[model samples]
Target: MLITQPSDLDPASPGPITIAQPLLDHLAAIRADVLASLASGEPVYGVNTGMGALSKVRLTTDEQKVHQRNLLLGRAVGGPPWLPDDEARAVLIGRLRTFLTGDAGVSVELIQQLVAFINSGHVPAIPAGGAGSAGEIIPLAHAFGPLAADLGPKEGIALLAGIPGATGRAALHAARARRLADRLSEIGAGAIAVIGANRGPYHPLTARGDDVLAAELTRLRNLVGPEPDPRSLQAPVSFRVAGPVIAHVRRTLTHLEAAVERAFTGVTDSPAYLDGEFVGTAGFHGIDLAAHCDHLTAALAHAAEVSTARLHRLLDPAVTGLPAQLAHEPGPQAGLVAVHKRAVATSHALRRLTLPSAIGTAETSNGQEDVQSFSWEAVGGLAEAIRLAREVAACELLAVHQALALSKRPVPPGLQELLLAVANVVPPIEADRPFGEDLTRLLDSVL
Candidate 1:
């Protein structure tokens, strides 16, 4: 966890430090090689010629230096609503990771400046949208625009050639989603215990050799206590399938982790230095990251749907064998009816956010950059989906806690601990009051 290189920068780490020696040595070697290549007068893309539509246009030695500065200035077209501090840090880390691969043909001085920028904690104001290229040209331009005067040789193309913006955003979302998935398991166990769900569904014999299901069964048994008498012949599908649904979410997260790992270590620049020569490549593409983000979005949407169903069951008298809406006075008080509506609305929004952004593409850059990953749009939508899902989870926890309070059956010790935490912030709903503040407190407590 020392963060000696870009790959060592953890999402949870507090801040950046000075670059270590091993990284400095690799950078020195790469810079020497790039200088050697330039001395040989070999035609290299972005170093001696124009970029994109003007690749065939060669440049004089003096013009090539000017091109470097112009590259950064021309692409600084990012808009408002800047990326937050943590995400901005992630963006720096992503670019630094790619730099460590020694494929961008940048100088040691430029690398040190980047390290200084990160360590000083001064995040550039990178706008929120406008990524239409194979690589994220606009955002990268804004991020590195302040340092444009320092760029040399092919460094300008190097800065814009990687998908760091998309990768950083995805990394932050993945970290948050992973934490939420863990909390989902605990909340699901509490809901199952409160509902008096049949132990039969969670039995080891019924797990079918799936490790995630088997693990969930053990967790539910511990929370609710073993061998509970069923309230009905069978519980609702939402109650019975909570274990499997959470298991699927975990599986999706695993796939996303693999994609993120690849992004961290892989070379994602065009005209990359590989096998001792500068080679043209499509390494800047972000389809793997974008596709996995779409998958995570779908998984979260499904979890929201399941949570809404469970909340509905808790509100209905026939399903829970409790008074309607968990009302203190069955006649006058409205109880959790409004809370149910809020949860339903959040679930609907989650579904809308799940439409895959990677499925569509529009050609830009005069058809030079025809296909795009749209990974930024995909990660942005997924981030919103995750936020809505957290709201849905808060609603379910509130309703389940209230339902458990109304039940006369003796609660297990483990469940009592969970109930104590919920009751600390969300008091038993005896009458109708503004539950918005209560919901916010509950979300903060649980998440």
Candidate 2:
């Protein structure tokens, strides 16, 4: 709970920062390397250096501060009007990380200031948009601008280092779309585990899975409690035909998790100048952080598709055995049948966000910028997808809980705990509660 460094970025951690002494040391080591390179006068790129396009330009000792200041300032360009505290905090953490990597030359004192700022809750202003994921310098602009008058050494890259807000908004959310989508996917799985829609679709040996699958299936059932009116799905619906759908979604969540892990832990770096002497590493290199991200998107997309399909099955009067809308009154009430439509729409919206971003590399940067990953875009897409998945989960969890209630029969032990928790939160449909409000709350819980 006394999180003090970016290294402590657990899901439960408030945002993108945790600024501890160890992380500061790691960052300081990077700075030391940069300074050592500069002191050696070894023509190190940024340290004794010239920047982009001017990779050949070397600076005099007298101009070092000016050079560093200019570099930092450029990174601060192009951001939106306002950003949330969490995102600003994320930017601070990213800027600190970049400087720590020795990739950017910054004083350790600045890192300390950032740590204090975060701990004291004095986050700066960051714009919402203007970053395409290759970098988020604009927000970094917001991050460091005020601290350094919106312009300083290595400022340009700093502005682009961290992402915008961590949450999903319609247009301006950051590159976390995939992580959000992964979250949504897991919630979808959780909803499925507790709800008795179609276990038959995912029987382990029935499809293609190993001992792990068997274990996961057992774990899934145990977590949820049990199927209500288990008799209805005792055959193919419960454990037979549903195999394909369940297997497909589980596979997707696993993939999505892999992607988020990569994003969280992956290090993307580039030679401020790719002299090839230093390998001028293009974090924008052969590695596809974006590709991995896109893979996650594809998985989440599959999860959304399958979950929505299951939702469809629940809505079908012929399938779930619930009154048309899981409502006793049906036609008069509009029931959850309409909510199912919204869920499908939400899933589709998430799917739409999954379109790959790395495909469209910027054609030219004065012949210098050959390819751009637009990684921010890819991350952003997955983040949006995750949010959509959450909405779908809200729909699914609610739908199943209602169905179980109507059955008035003992739900299978596998789904009992989660079902009861859900039931307690919203209860089996009382008279016409505003489901939208309830949905918002449900998603907040899972996502």
Candidate 3:
């Protein structure tokens, strides 16, 4: 769908992107205001005078155009093949929003034209790992590739302020990963439910069952199944907590979903000229989105940990109430013993990846860059967290399936459907099966 448009932005989740009108409207307004101020010979910081160290110097009316034009031309020093599709769109739209308020003095048509280029798929190549301080100066160089030829006084600074390009790519990656985490937790929780293992930490209940308790209970009954399976007795309690565990993961997805929506449609602005007034504020800062992404990343990683713990329980005969690793004979066959090691390692690694990026900062770039939202880092980490979670979920599904098979008994009523769903694709293990092949089929339904 065309994410740039309001209609398109409404239904979408998150990922790569494009731009739409609010961005254009923003740019047009900024351009007109700057021009009007220039035409009136009013002394403004960027629109009429030199910038940075040179801001005190005033420009003549004719020189104002020269200065604005020169700012775009000279700062056009942005080196690149160009920015990636998603980042470019983010930058373009982000930059457009800045000017749209008429503070930056950028032309409306110019902003519209840039969005047009994006819609047409004219992606400029941008490099990775350009982590400079001072509001993503290096990344902005690549981000501004499209509008290189035309810039205003503070326009370049506005465009470069806080590398939203990197942030965009990171946001997209985080969103995709969080969804995978969601699915992983659901299937992982499902496996836990199948085994009936004792609950550990994460609960669906808040301290006050005031809002989500009933809602979660309703969801539990609706999604988990009607009765427990007897074969599922091998790991009795696993299927029960699946509801709340899955619910925790569900909350994370809800946040990621909102983040993705904003990836294309968010208008971060401060000092924006809304309607007819110059409204100065902090919308330009993306701390809110970064925080949301950070929270999701951390929560999803925990979800992975919860699932991995459940997979380990499958190996404990006392835990699963069945053969170790759900082995058929229990003595000779290794069963799921080694399989769980993978799950444990994967979960640990994902948890490590969950370290919040929003708090990351450094004093660099000649001290021009200090604290940072680290939004890009946060989003980038999310994708990794998501992938690891999928692997972990696959492990749980296999473990649960194996535990049920070794029961040598009927499956629990509630777990029966989930088991059938698994068995529909996976054959019972005899001596040993190709682990990879078994994992692949097992994950077909869950992962």
Candidate 4:
């Protein structure tokens, strides 16, 4: 990958990174300027002076040389569940973007070592949880410390300065959430067919100039087509509000996408070099990224709750006018009743993760670093939410497939393949055999 700009970094790409000589030369010049500032007997925050609580303490020449190395070794804390290979690559890509602009004043040699590590296709075992530092020092140390035996003046601080741990995972999570969002729309379309819900709410004019709602309405309209003989004049609130709820998810996703883009492209160096002088900056703080992640997680949890409501509707005899629970015989075979229970459980679990991680604050490093973004926790929460959200989708699909089968209504052409796929893994609720295994298969092979 050739990185001419921060936007050039593609975390999803498998790569050996390459930088043009001019950019490398530019970085070298910045390094020289930083070194000159250090040589003039002036204090630079992690160079000739101490860091954090010891910022005012001056260092000897020998201490200055070893400070960079010690910074990484001392900060490598915590243990596994290390980041998976893809997320590790993303962290590396985020780190590389920090280096591209030379604001951190990192050496080109250090930059090359980072490139070499990426090109080698091996990642260090950086811990995926228990990260509570002011920035991402713990994970950053685990990721980069072993690669370089020695680091120049500002290189160590540069490596530890940004919240790449959060940014990298957020980028991946936002993409994953988007896919989940689209799949939920398709699943909602299936439920509409099975429920024979009133078609009024899906009318284009109901959108009221909201593009996201309009798009969802169009999708549902096309998928369910003409519902000539609807079961009710107005469906349950859950069914009526499906379009708006899904449109809300899309909006939250849009907010996350914008935040991730800004993080990837913005400078995030603490004590960044500006106008040929070292200056402290709050660029390391990631409140925007953290809060947006919380928003998306909460939105997904709401979607799951709505999906569970719709699943319950499919089981109600009054709603569907079909056999209760879509069972062949309601007495001996419990049918999809237990499935709705599981949906309820999963939906509640997802709801618990909606608490905002960004609202919490802590003091560390002798109170020199007094507050944190809790960005890692935010992204991690979303990751779990994605898994639970999909499981909820699986539950709703099971009910939709069973209800449509018992209804004897012709399946919509758009939903034929989906119901057919569900039927492949989740055989009809013929005698209420263990549904846990069927749900497992649906999650593994289908959803």
Score each candidate by Cα lDDT.
0.81, 0.53, 0.56, 0.85
- Give a tens-digit lDDT track for model 3, residues 1-447: 343433343211323345556665655655666556546665555556665457668877667645644654444344534444665565555544444334444565555565566566565555444443434455555556566566654455455443345445554555555556445544554555455543422233532453443455454444444443433433433344445555666676576656655643444432333554434334434565667777776776776667777777667876557766677766777777777788778878887876666565777534534666665555556656666777777777777777666655455455566668778877877766567677777656645
RMSD value for candidate 4:
2.1
Candidate 1 lDDT over residue span 1-447, tens digit each:
354767776554565566678888878888888788778888888879888878888899889878887887898887888878877777876787688778887887888888788888889998777777787888888888877986788888888887877787788888899888877877787777777778788775677878877876676677767644777778899988887888788888888888888886787887888767889887777899888889999999999999999988888888878888888877798878888899999999899987777676788767787888887777777778889999999988888778878876566776677677888988777888898888999878867
Per-residue lDDT for 1-447 in model 2, tens only?
344443344432353344567766766666565445445667655545665567777878767666655664666666455555655565455445444444444556766665567667677766555554334444554566556633334434433442222211211222344344333333344445434445544444553546545645554445444444443544323223233333444555455445434443444444442121233444433224455556656666766666677766665666655677677687667677777888878877877776676676664435555566665556556556666766776787787777666656466565555556666567558456678877876666544
Instruction: Point to the candidate with the largest lDDT.
Output: 4
Off by over 4 Å in 3: 1-30, 40-105, 127-134, 150-155, 162-178, 181-185, 196-210, 226-245, 252-267, 274-281, 327-333, 358-360, 364-369, 404-446
362-419 per-residue lDDT for model 4 (tens digits): 8898999888888877888988998999999999987887888888889898877877
What TM-score against the true fold does each predicted structure earn? 0.94, 0.76, 0.71, 0.93
Best by TM-score: 1
Error of 2 at 338 (Å): 1.2
Candidate 3 minimal-lDDT segment of 10 residues = 5-14
What lDDT does candidate 1 reach at residue 158? 86
Q: Which of candidates 2 and 3 is the stronger one according to TM-score?
A: 2
**Candidate 4: where is the Cα deviation over 4 Å?**
14-17, 20-22
Mark the 10 consecutive residues where model 4 has the least summed lDDT.
6-15
